[model samples]
Target: MKNSPTAGYHTKSAVLFVVFNRPETTKRVFEAIRIAQPKRLYIVADGPRRDYPGDVEQCKQTRQILSLIDWDCEVKTLLREENAGCKNGVSSAINWFFEQEEEGIILEDDCLPANSFFKFCDTLLEKYRYDTRIRHITGCNLQFGKKWGDASYYFSNRTHVWGWASWRRVWNDYDVNLTKYDGTEVKAQLKNIYNDDFVADAWTNIFNELKAGKINSWAYPLDFCNFFNNGLVIIPNENLVTNIGFKAGATHTVDEESSYANIPLIEIGEITDPVFFVPQKQADLSIINRDFNIEQRRVKHNAWHRKLKRWIKSKLK
Candidate 1:
């Protein structure tokens, strides 16, 4: 990995790398970080499950691989002794990261970011550090081939967390339980943001599932917090991060054929301000139709199958 240093800009930004039992993916992502040569690096790893055989050894190997950080930098480690699962583990790790630093770039083990991703995040983290309107700066561009404008990036309501950066102030308001707002308020807020009843209802169900303890996820709650607060995410015009952890061993991403699995990465240049700070409706709708709608349909299909199975069992009885 060759470092593409932006002119007149040194890599002073702090980076937080979240990892688990995967040493192969961690090694790849670490190479990209090595190129950037950040002054400070924070590593967070969750403890392996005691019930899963070979997990402890794999976890040990992952941490050992991270020790290959040969750059002249200060490294901090937060290794958990007990398994906290994904929802609690990741959210708590992020909370710990923000406690020490004001702002920084965050990357998961599986999200292999381009060398340019570091520069793009470093620029925007300072640019919008005080702007409450913008909450997240994401390295994902799921808009397919569409460029919102001539700017290097655009505002989006969708929270693409593959690779991202944010300030402590924005993260301070993160509620994993969605405890700040009630159901009625959340639905009304989504309705206003999308201006569509069906879309609003669909999202309301997702929040309900989160509240009902049906889904164990950390990213959805962040999206909910940002949307409820009318916060915008900065999305690069070209995708700068690729997800390479969609395999059998993965927890959430099991589908190898996912459209978002191995998206091509492009080098992002210096950050440019968009004409407007508003979320792009066209891009949002495309995401809703392509990602959200497909997931919702899959849920409904599974529900139908379960219902049919119960009916047949009752008839046989």
Candidate 2:
């Protein structure tokens, strides 16, 4: 539980890297990956959209950036010829990656992970490889307290979309059809997915978008699908990865709103005890409470409170 080095640090497995048209961020992410030195790497680059004026050039640049991986690993590329956007691009790429491998570590374009993050994933993958209840291994945690172990990895009801890992068997149950919720069993499951009244409206909007075909492609539903079946997500106590695509040109992250930027840096450590899945009830409760509080706090507090928090962090820094 102390800050000891992770066991089997030398053993590396396949890592699926998903990228869009951001060449600079992609370069930085690859640098982090190179240091981790995975044995097999799967690169998925989204193609350019025909309507976008500069998409062709940007897509070419993204591909060229991916070509710069200097590691001696078995590398495979899933470069799309047409733009699939975030929904389709991420979904198809992840589906394709899981189809080939039993398990893999998944990273996005802007998630620059610490070297230790790779170790955490590799260890967890080996630790929970046989546990069917544990559905995901997440690399981001907003609350970076030492209340838990050195890793502080725990099961949560909600899935974090930052950097994460999962097995193919877990992903096989993902259903994109939003209409299935009309059934009796699915409505009961929907209560668990939304967790509470405050966040249910937002989820309803997302589901509506999916139903209306407004979103050409998406993956959050798949994440929700795992949660609906009572899947567990492993989250790091320390904030090992930083997302860097809040600026313009980011497809989905255009909102200027910021929340709790203080992420603690934790050193990855070995697990003396074998990893086990957290009980289903506890996992679901943690997810429900955590998700509800986070959304409620952000919405209830005004801009002045956010600025005050920012100022406090600045002073502390």
lDDT against the true structure, each candidate? 0.87, 0.70
> TM-score: which candidate is best?
1
| Model 1 misplaced regions, further than 4 Å | 1-10, 294-317
The regions of model 2 sitting more than 4 angstroms off are: 1-11, 144-151, 178-180, 183-187, 192-195, 200-205, 215-217, 260-265, 271-317
Q: How close is candidate 2 to the true structure, as a TM-score?
A: 0.78
Model 1: ten consecutive residues of lowest lDDT: 1-10
Clashing pairs in 2: 87-217, 87-218, 88-217, 157-287
Colliding residue pairs in candidate 1: none
Candidate 1 on 1-317: residue-level lDDT in tens?
53343343345689999999999999888888887888899999989998997889989999995557776778899998788999999999999999999999999999999888888898888888888898999998887778999999999898889999999999999999888777867788898899876578778989999999899999999999888888999999999999988888798998999888888898866677898888997798888878668456767878999999999999999
Candidate 1: Cα lDDT at 148 = 93
Winner by lDDT: 1
lDDT string for model 2 (66-135, tens) is 5566556788898888888787678788889989999988899888777788888888888889988788
